[model samples]
Target: SGSFVVAVDTDVMGRGSEELGKTLMKGFLFAVSQLPSLPKTVLFYNGGAHLTCQGSASLEDINALADKGVDIRTCGTCLNFYGLTDKLEVGSVTNMYEIVETLAQAGKVVKP
Candidate 1:
């Protein structure tokens, strides 16, 4: 299959209720983990940075994805802005240029 990537720009999955969104995000990650064909990479930025760091409910699933060879990356600038520079639990830091390249080079991009 052609390479695909997931781009998360928020800590939650949708707008409105924060709790519901978080719950959905947790489930979303878990569902992704169950897929036979995994994403080539998962990029976290903006509020999405919170999901790959400490205190996130989705950490276990995200880590599982990482363990399975998914390239997990969180924006370095976003980590600093959120004061989570050292709390990254699942992935390494990445830059804007890399983010752009990843998205651009991907055959398909999924946002959820």
Candidate 2:
């Protein structure tokens, strides 16, 4: 087991135009990527899963995190429900069982 921080990106941040929201999300991910000790994993569910899929504005940053050894996982059920399974571009697909276990074993679980 290892330390972990969970990022639950629910609405792309802020409350305004979708364009602004997307920009904010990109900035957030970029900041996260600059962290010295990055999170062990990033779990995306619900709308957050969109950040790990095709056409995401923050895909480059997310891909950087993945290259740095972060476990980027998007909810499998969510992708299917949202019809984005084939559109995924980063990370791996994960189920609730693993999600629950990962969160439970994490040293710090952060929802953002």
Candidate 3:
């Protein structure tokens, strides 16, 4: 199939205060969702795992991606470490094995 995979490395969009960082992250995801062709997968890891769970400002956009047939996967270990395992909403909980495999097999791996 013709698809791209995007990996999110951190919860915040860029470097700065937590509040500003979160705002940027939300804007980024929302913008991505508006693209005519969405990514096939969106992998969330590290601090980025927080963006797929409950209470995330970007939850609506992320859920829209899921509805559009994107595979939204969040790292299980990261979620547990962050004490957010129970908060996951829009995606599957994935382990490191799957994460590495998904990235390795993606047509394109965009980190943002």
Candidate 4:
């Protein structure tokens, strides 16, 4: 099987009101989690770091992916920059090298 990756670089799915964007994002992750073919990994970076942190509405969905063996990784630099270092809720901290390598090795990459 060709394993894919999900890279989320922002908390919102698109440009617009933050509130609505977040709702869309939550729906997106939920849908992803229910996919018949699960992804190999889900990478969170930049503003997307918020999705893996405490108080994030997407935690349940993200955690569901994790329970199914999805590798959830958050950019260490981004988490620190966002002051969410201690708030990471569902993944391990990752570096640029690992991020690049994971993407490079993936059969396909999905970003949303």
Q: State the lDDT of candidate 4 residue by residue for 24-45, as single tens digits.
A: 9999999999999999999999
Index of the highest-lDDT prediction: 4
Clashes of each: 0, 0, 0, 0
Ranking by TM-score: 1, 4, 3, 2
- lDDT at 72, model 1: 95
Q: What's the lDDT for residue 85 in model 1?
A: 98
What are the runs in model 4 whose C-alpha is more than 4 Å off? none
Q: Model 1 Cα displacement at 76 (Å)?
A: 0.3
Model 2 per-residue lDDT tens digits across residues 13-58: 7787887877777888888889888899999999998889888888
lDDT of each: 0.93, 0.85, 0.88, 0.94
Selected candidate, larger TM-score, 1 vs 3: 1
lDDT of 3 at 100: 90
Instruction: Arrange candidates, best lDDT first.
Output: 4, 1, 3, 2
The candidate 4 region of ten consecutive residues with least summed lDDT is 1-10
Model 1 misplaced stretches (Cα beyond 4 Å): none
Question: In candidate 3, what are the lDDT values of residues 35-90, reduced to their tens digit?
Answer: 88889899999899989988888899999999988899999999999999999998
Please say which candidate is ahead in lDDT: 1 or 3: 1
92: Cα error in model 2, Å: 0.5
- After superposing candidate 2 on the true structure, give the runs of residues whose Cα lies further than 4 Å from its correct spot: none
Q: What is the TM-score of each candidate against the true structure?
A: 0.96, 0.89, 0.92, 0.96
